[model samples]
Target: MADPPPAPWIGSVAPESVLWPGVRGTQQAAEWHNAPIDFWFLPKYAHLPHPVVPDENIGGMLTQLSATLRQRLDAVPPTPPPRRTRPGERQDNSRLKTYRTRLRPNTQQMEALRKTAGIVRWTYNRAVEYLKAHPNASFHDVREHSVTEDGLPLMNLSWVTPVLYSIREQAFFDAHTALRNGLADVRAGEIPNFELKFRKKRALFSSFRIRTRDWDGGCLKIPNFSLGPGQHQTKIQTGIDVPSLEHDGACIKQENGSWFLLWQKDMGEEKMRVPAARGPEMCAIDPGVRTFATIYDPLRGTAAKFGDGDHKRLFRLDTHLDELISGSTQASAKKKCYRMRRAANRLRARIRHLVDELHWKLRSYLKQSFDTVLLPKFNAHQMSRRGQRRIGRKTVRAMMTWAHGRFRSRLNEAMEVV
Candidate 1:
């Protein structure tokens, strides 16, 4: 291969961005994070080839650069991070909630994600194994030994060492936290044993969490998720066309045969003046199989049914999937199994689309029309079980397939702060 593109960046500029005063353009209609930062270079800095760096914080970077150029042009030093409130004074926090959607990644991107996740899993497993040998070892001890020169063979992290060093640090930090918490629990007699939870590849430990403070434009650059100091942006992260909202971090997972990026998005909306609470003109929702919702307004003494939201579509999609599976068996399956995984993936997409549409419709309608919405708590597992004394196996099967819990969650998400 030709010599790798020269490292476009020299060193992390002091206080981050120093070339902002020259930004003449913002964004081109292009792929989200991979696009170059279009800036107007000053005459003095014209010799520099493509000063644009691979960071998603272009807006914030430019803002900083503008300030830096102002200072330099006026013969003064650059400024630092934004001013904070009275030294130790605290700011009041409002009720915040996270709304998240699955991230869609291409084949190449999915493989890269899988590789990164593998690194975390391997490191975690290796660290646990080493700690077992030296039961008295502390977090610091295990961390130091795992990545050091002499400890090379102990974990063999040559592949992911440099490219994913920060991510590894994050993984170890999480492991340390778990160990510390377990130790504390043992001392306090909270549980009988202090065995730390092992990280598994495909179970409750399937997800790999990441909180990136760096400027790699992949996923962390989305709105409130970016830890860098700058004005919060409203742009989408990578290729996902999601609404702009704040989230703490993202957890990466491979579900079925695809990757998912899960994060909590704040669901609050700008306040529109309400013409009073309307004195408890309340509404109650009763869920049903034939109809998705039955709304009862006691004040008006009226009852109305909302048709089985997406259940029909879900059932239709399920039928299509069954047909696909049955046909796949006829495709030269003597040598090897020939089920079309791609068709199965399409069925999954159909289910996903239906669920999304249902959630959006329910949330918007309830918020816009009702004053007080009362949703009954449900146990879907118990509801789905057809005990020996029970009837309607088909009903139980339908109940199991439908997303009752997700519907309840959407209703809860719609509730405003009291």
Candidate 2:
């Protein structure tokens, strides 16, 4: 069939600027100029049918939306976007995508969320303490007796509305799970120093994961918070107290100043029946220390290589922390501890960002560009051993510290598309 002609734009604005769903001030939608209005929702919206409900019911509503709305939406341009990879950018075949958006919160709403986090941290700690005291406590017993009348008085805490919020249930499970795992680890001789960890108020991130059922488009409907009116495209019937979320899969991160919600929507080949044969064959994937990875196909005479990250700053930070700890008095020990933790956090963040980026890019590039990725499994523990005195200290440390397990998992996720 012959397709409709492309929609006309007024000046720099899109044809249906006011009504277009994919055009917005978001990370993903910022590239709307690259795709036609008809192809606007192609990547994310490909799963959905034409109508949310019956056509007749929505027909009257559609008529109300300007007369040229359907024409504007349906018309397609000749060329499609993302034809080839950019010089440096990596692509993946993974269907899961996360959408993040800022939240507009007043003072009260922010505090309410913080309180929820505090209660969760407290609950987790209390569970650990109970398990420690009673060595023979079963998982069921720990779950039951973790939050009780005689202990932490979690039931008496009037502020914690456990019934209204679904995160409360997850928090309860997290506490129970932590104790169970800690005990099991102790039994396995994992924690040699009798070091069952405890959760502290300063240590927890002030964000809670929502159940999939509770999450609607852009907004999370928790018990206390409400998704108020005067917002954009809020089809969900929620109050002002609810917080608007972006995507699912990603967690709700409470930053230094305010809360930012990161969400992800998983895309699948089974659901979409997307063909992998559209791309070339990739024979081997080598996760290298020199570069991040090396992909080669002898038959095609083509190769793809990913670069490694420089973690010198992390080692420098660790050295600084060690220096601060050694030759220090008891009075300055607490200060040194704080310094060490802060440095460790920065190091962790750096590693996490680099590794995650590498994983995402490599996985995506392989998925879109290759039909199949053949990977030979290597034992990370064996490869990551500390070198003998023959090697330099830096080289030995590098071997000891590389996170090969995480790298493997990322490769696995990216290749699981088919």
Best by lDDT: 1
- Give Cα-based local distance difference scores for all models: 0.52, 0.50
Count of clashing residue pairs in every prediction: 5, 16
lDDT per residue for candidate 2 within 190-248, as digits (tens), equals: 78545457766675246655555455553544444443232432323222323443332
Candidate 1 — worst ten consecutive residues by lDDT sum?
Answer: 39-48
Per-residue lDDT over 41-140 for candidate 1, one digit per residue giving the tens place of the 0 to 100 score: 1001112212344355754654564455344434533354543222122232233544345666555445556667777777777676776677677766
Worst window of 10 by summed lDDT in candidate 2 = 40-49
Per-model TM values vs. the true structure: 0.54, 0.52
